[model samples]
Target chain A: MRNSIDTGAVICSVFAAVALFGAGSLLALMGYLVLKGLWPPMRALAALIFAHSGDSLLSIWIRSLFLLLAATLLALPLAIGTGIYLSEYTRQNRARELILSNIAGLGEMPPVVYGLVGWGALAPYFGEDRQTLVIVLTASVWLLPQLIVAAYWALQEIPVSFRRDSLALGATRWQTIRWTLMPYSGRLLAAKTLEGMARVGGEAAPVIMVAAAWPDSSKQPLHILPYYLYRSLIEAVDPATTRHFGAALLLVLTSVCFQWAALRLRRTGVVAGDTLPGLRKR
Target chain B: MRDSKLVVRNLSVYYGDFQALRSINLSIPLGAATAVIGSSGAGKSSLLRALCRMNELWDNVRTEGQVLLDGQEIYGPDVDVTEVRRRVSLIARHPYPFPKSIFDNVAYGPRLHGIKDKRKLDEIVKRSLKQAGLWNEVKDRLQESALNLSPGEKARLCIARSIAVEPEVLLIDDPTYHLDPVSAAKVEDVILELKQKYTLVFATNSMQQAGRVSDYVAFLSEGALVEFGPTSEVFARPKDRRTEDYITGRFS
Candidate 1:
């Protein structure tokens, strides 16, 4: 008993230390970014928000939001459909395993490869006039594999008994997926989608290959936060450092908001009796 | 038997390379409670699942041989799998109330078969819940989430849900495995009552429960049927040494 108690205490202390370290690092980073980044760009951000005219930080932030929404809208249905097909309809076979392995491989491929594909392959068909469309398509392609994997895992996380019970009640496979599996995994799917949106909001490489660096007389203006930050850093000037920091701050804020929304959704689902009664007590 | 509701011939079940149930033949009587009793991993649940084709839901699960319901082969190519399931439903040991209201949980089966009239659904739900002996406790809270019910209530609610579709056979796989003694007794009572109407095939680990609730008992040991006969005769006579030992508490 004494040895077990000591071991338990040691495990608890180790976990506590890890938790403290993570929280401390996040706080330190946020404090530094707020002091250095938010302060320098406060006036310009305010002006951009109010005027909505030029390619300023806030304008780029809004544009990033738009791109994130558009790309997510394009990718979500296809990813969910593919996920459902893989998880529910297919039996365990060599072909299914091969397809899943390929999807996993695609998820790990660099975003720059997707950007290169968009530039070399799709640009000619779309022509120079539809650069924004190409950029949106490239971003959606990058986001698709990740979202598909997310959706598959989310559906997998539902208890097998739900499917069994539904089927035992004479529900068709489609009805089971529609009524039980979808509702039970809805919050998880939404959380994953939000996390994906956070990632796409801050992605720079794919956008750069498809979008022009700066707004020129000949080029269409396509300002997003990540591209703005990339440009600011590459300039390598003192003011550019502050601008990049500000952009970094905005990206971090967007990610934090997405994470917060995900957490809030999970909590709200539990409170609203989305979880099983047996699990709710725990 | 001429009165048999379901006939199983050379039934074998395999999960990957592991065979859970060996080739076994049995006949379940109509409008009577037949108990499949065995110890853990003794293929009782497999037999129940196989009766209604529920075993096919799992991946890598291969079921062989024939299961006939009312002289019709359920595994035949022309048979509608969904129709078979609707005709013969399995009530799992654990209750899984969908994340829906009590009314919806019971109405789920009827609705799946395309019953859209609200009045008809309401009547079915009421009758089913009443038949399961859960109507008095839950009638006021029919709109409440089924998850909020106690363990015993949830078990009965699952029974209610299963019967709402009015299936011919009710294959209950250890309905009281997770319930307390009082709750277990209550579920046993519901099972006893249900046998008067539906052809009930119950799988259990308890010999006493088998004696209490079943008219005919099929004793299984290690994926094979050891003995099967009327419960009173099987309890008294030693047709097989293993069945005699099991009923006498010499071994599980």
Candidate 2:
């Protein structure tokens, strides 16, 4: 009661004020953008979603989505296998340590390098003018490390008792992995895969080299919003800025949705290293 | 002894340089319940794991022994681990129900063993649940995720899953350890019922549990089998001082 100004409360209030100030500035910026030329942005979004002069917005969106899907589907099995092998099978062996040490670096490698690898080695296998296929292959390879790390972490979190129980029930190692292990981490898998898909959605450098070659051709195998926005924002300054804003909005929305979904999934699913959320109250 | 379903001779287990179980001779009789009772680190769990060869999962774990199931060596070089586990199923202290429907958890074992027919799987699941005394409680919500079940029901579901595989032996590690009084009583009742058909080997630290559910009792102390005989005889008259000390609460 002697010194009624509680220092802790004052400090916390200051921090809260600072946070609100930062958020306020962000809101002001967004509000200004939304208020200025709001109609053009809206119309641009409509055009992107409904119809466009160069490509059907719906078709390109579909193609981009499917490219993400196809690349992930193609590469996931191998990545998941690596993850399971690392978490479930390998012990304090050298192989595990080596792979664990190198995986993050491999995963974070420049997307351009992956594109070159796809172009030089994989292109010959698929034949000429298969740029879309090359792009898909590059994206898949680029995503491999992230997928493996995420899935391996998820696999590691599952209680060892699950595997033991499965084995005790006379299930082989593969069967236990397929049935017991997979179901436990299914949500984590989906969350990570979605997050990966979102990351791929924003990448352009690797995709631009492969996709730009046939920009005017009839066989428009791939046309992603991010790449289109990049060109529109930089090259066509006057005509495409409004459409770029819409595309930018869509990109940010997709990224945020994936992140939100991942967070929610992690909250609900039984994760390793933390007490289960459902059981926390008890 | 000659009529035993599983025989262990001079069994010893070690994790790296640290030994967990000493040379132990044990015989689990056919169609009867056998309990290995001891203190916290008495190697009861290791004995159960040894029987099913589950200990091999641990790195640097060494086992020197002979575990015979139906006159076949379980720890033999050529014996497949999955096959050994199929014959000798293990139920752990804590329940681990897959995040699936109750029916799916029970059907997992049968399905893994190549029982693909839905009707046959349903029958096995139902029968196993009935045997584990959990059928009535989970009859309606067979489709719901097993994670929703209460702790006691989860334990029973694990039992149902194990027995669904139709194993010849069950190596249970303290089914009643963490359960409420009523749940423990139910589990004990299920054990009594199960002993009539399949051999049961319980790894429990509770002396009272061994007396209640087991026909024969093996008193283990500090990883060594101190006394092994009929439950009535051992509880009435323990031959070894260590076993008597344990039973009389002299010192665990």
DockQ scores of all models, one per candidate: 0.65, 0.67
| Model 1 per-residue lDDT tens digits across residues A1-282 | 899999999999999999999988877888798878667677765564456557667777877788778988999999999999998888868997798888878877887888787777777678777777777887888889888887887787676777888899898999999988888778888988898788777778876776542234245335688877887787676654466777787888888899899877766552254444443210
Tell me how many clashing residue pairs each candidate has: 0, 0
Regions more than 4 Å wrong, model 2: A1-37, A40-52, A55-63, A92-94, A110-128, A205-223, A236-240, A267-282
lDDT string for model 1 (B77-110, tens) is: 9988888888999997776787689999999999
Error of 2 at B97 (Å): 2.3
Interface RMSD of each: 1.6, 1.2
Candidate 1 stretches with Cα past 4 Å from truth are: A1-21, A24-28, A37-44, A93-95, A212-218, A236-245, A267-282
The alpha-carbon lDDT assigned to residue B69 of candidate 2 equals 90
Model 1: per-residue Cα lDDT at residue B120: 99
After TM-score superposition, the amount by which residue B225's alpha carbon in candidate 2 deviates from its true location, in angstroms, is 2.0
**lDDT string, candidate 2, A162-259, tens digits:** 78788888889888888878987878887887888788767877766654444454456546767766767667867645666556655665676777
